[model samples]
Target: MLTHPTLNQLHALGLHGMAKAFVDIQASGDAASLGHAEWLALLLEREASLRHDKRLSARLRYAKLRQQACVEDIDYRTPRGLDRALFAQLAEGSWIDAHANLLICGPAGVGKSWLASALGNKACRDNRTVLYQRVPRLFSELALARGDGRHQRLLRALGRVDLLILDDWGLEPLDAAARHDLLEILEDRYGRRSTIVTSQLPVDQWHALIGDPTYADAVLDRLVHNAHRLELSGESLRRVRAQQAARTA
Candidate 1:
């Protein structure tokens, strides 16, 4: 049956819209016909390529990307003084193997979230498990967890992802229990999994956001070590876009 020539076989191979007439002629099935074997070969090749494309498409959709998000679309190279080589190195899976984390710090609208989300997208595409959470929303979930007595289970779910992306950090001050939860998540995942954190504030000010000196110090101590840190400096990309629009008008 695999040796027989058929239009369905050719369509399966890759000539996406081959007319039924062509297939009907091919499927006539004369035993000595070389056309059948040729068509079969073509179909086999097309099937392989289509399978590859399907796999790639599945990976992209499984990424669960936010709107207008992707690392490839991010203008990292356009950002002045940003290290492309370092970004490439991190993009490779080896950085995680080395137990290193990534910190994407910059002013608002400077592509910090774009970059972090891009990396998370990459991890997902690589078939590694990932989770994305905004700090405020995640903390709110944690607050609910505490009320429902499922805080530890929730934290464990977070800790288990191969990569975790925490976006918009320092947006709100942490109270004692939230601080403890954050620290515990970091410590538990520390050296076991990797994290990508995006924040508008400087690392020096993280102490201020966490609010408890002792706990903040402990948190910083674990995060800063064995981490690949990138500090971005530039005007807001949104403001730049608006200015360009006005100029065009």
Candidate 2:
């Protein structure tokens, strides 16, 4: 019989407390111990940690990205007038090294979100850290954190993420404090990590949406200074899909 070490010994070896439950079940030879379902459950439980691993999420978000969300899936071979060089940069993973921001600016339905999300998913897959949040959601979380006296903690947490995606930036106007908080977050992460922002409004009008010129300038300076600007100038891929479906019908 294999001798079982005390839980303290496991802890000394850096095993998580949750590992005790698995050990207990295994020792007792419970219904779950030797079953495939139980094995899968244990695997999934371990994966729960990935949700909090920002670096891992960032990499997986990129590596395991869905094909539909990728720019490579779109045909640049045709004379559709898409920016080929930008696509090449994205494909080459240059942004991953430069720690530069990615600005996806274009009209709605032009696959801006798809491309940004794909990149984010790719980052997650590559074992880098990443988080995805809409502009409104991010502001709301920060506001709640501030109200709860955890604003600094929240900012620090955002700073530590390897890649942060702020999607739908122009969906709503930002107030003074919210705009300021955004600026701080951007400045903190400036050249330290990467950020991918998808916006319908052009960079020039970002100040108008931010609602404060000085803060907006400071924010844009950090964001645009070391960023990869990809203007997704194409018709809505959704529209194209619909048209193809109709033609098939």
Candidate 3:
């Protein structure tokens, strides 16, 4: 019974999954058929699965993926010049294990952000922490952090994430403060954390986009040199989707 002291104890100990399984097994009268080892294994497996789902849910919530997207949802039929074999390799998440970065650069609307978000979602599903932030908004937050004296804390948090997706990179020009903040972030995350940068600008132009030559060198040094590149091409996927919708309509 829910009123039982043992059930209460299980709840108190935060073993809700096990407690629920116990109740279900008892109600189903499986205790007579299941050996002790079998019952124990069932309970433990339920608890483990529940815990994994909870962790994944928390990570996805914190990730702010915007589209609730996943890798399988990607539209490979759009002829985006994407390399299926290479993306297949990336889907395995070995790049993250190597602490390498990803550069997704292309014109607007080709699903750069979507691809990055898919990768981020995959990272979350794999039990790795991920954060998705647009570069412009992230810079604004960093500036605010500096004003509120939480700049270092923000950098530390970014450093701890298993994968960081900086979407909409090169959307705006970076001033001195933003340049410095970007450099600081890259420096902290360099060689230890993996990042996925989705930018409309090519990597070659990132230098001018960052403004200061020195900061550009430092930031790109930490980010670009060792990174894997995925340059999305062809017309924007949004246009393609819209055309498809119109035809259906």
Candidate 4:
């Protein structure tokens, strides 16, 4: 019979999940039908599952995904010019472990951000720390961090995330400060963490967009060297979807 002392001990050891399972089993008298080994296994399994769930929830919360998209929920049927094989490979998350980056480029409203968010969501589910922020917003936040004298702190946070998704790249011009800030962020994560960038401009135009050849060289050197490029080609998905909806209505 399970007793109060046993439950208290389980809770003390930070096995609250198991402790609750034990209490439930005792109340139901279900443990009486199981052998000692089986009962212990059941308790341990419950504890493991509970911890896994809690950890995943925490990762997702911290991810701050813009679209709440998942790899499984991707609209592969929408003709967004994505390579299914490449996406399938990325879903395995091996590139993350290898410290590789992903560069996704496409026109506006073509699901570039959604794909990046989906990849980020998958990273969170894989128990990896992730952050999703627009490139403009990231620069703004960095500026604020500098104002508050927490610039290094913010950069460190960005550096330590297992996967960083920067959306809307090339949508806005970057000043000298923004370029240097971006370089610092990338320099910290280079060869240590993975990054996912979604840009409306082609890779060839990035240097010109950065507006500084030297900084562009330094930044792209770290990013493109060990990156997997996904050059998406398609029309505005939003417009197409709207047309389809109108026809249905």
TM-scores of the candidates are 0.75, 0.69, 0.95, 0.94
How would you encode candidate 1's per-residue C-alpha lDDT over 206-228 as one tens digit per residue?
88889999999889887877788
**What lDDT, from 0 to 1, does candidate 4 have?**
0.91
Best by lDDT: 4
- Where model 2 places Cα greater than 4 Å from the true spot, the runs are 1-81
Cα TM-score of candidate 4: 0.94
Q: How far off is residue 38 in model 2, in Å?
A: 31
Q: Could you tally the backbone clashes for each prediction?
A: 2, 24, 0, 0
| Cα lDDT of model 2 by residue, 116-186, tens digit | 76776655555666667778878898888887889999888778787787888889898877888898899
Q: Is candidate 1 or candidate 2 better by TM-score?
A: 1
Q: Superposing all C-alpha atoms, what RMSD in Å does each candidate have to the true structure? A: 5.5, 7.8, 1.6, 1.6
Off by over 4 Å in 3: 1-3
Q: Pick the candidate with the highest TM-score.
A: 3
Expressed as tens digits, the lDDT of each residue in 1-95 for candidate 3 is 44388678988999999888888898898778999899899889989989999999999999999677788887677788899889988989999
- Comparison by lDDT, 1 against 4, better one: 4
141 Cα displacement, candidate 4 (Å) = 1.1
Clash pairs (backbone) in predicted model 3: none
**Tens-digit lDDT string for candidate 4 (1-249):** 338889989999999889988988888988779999988898999999999999999998888898978899877887777999999999899999999999999889899888888888888888899988889988998988888999999899999999999989998899988999999989999999999999989899998998999999999999988999888887899999899999999
List runs of model 1 lying over 4 Å from the truth. Answer: 1-63
How far does residue 8 in candidate 2 sit from its true spot (Å)? 19
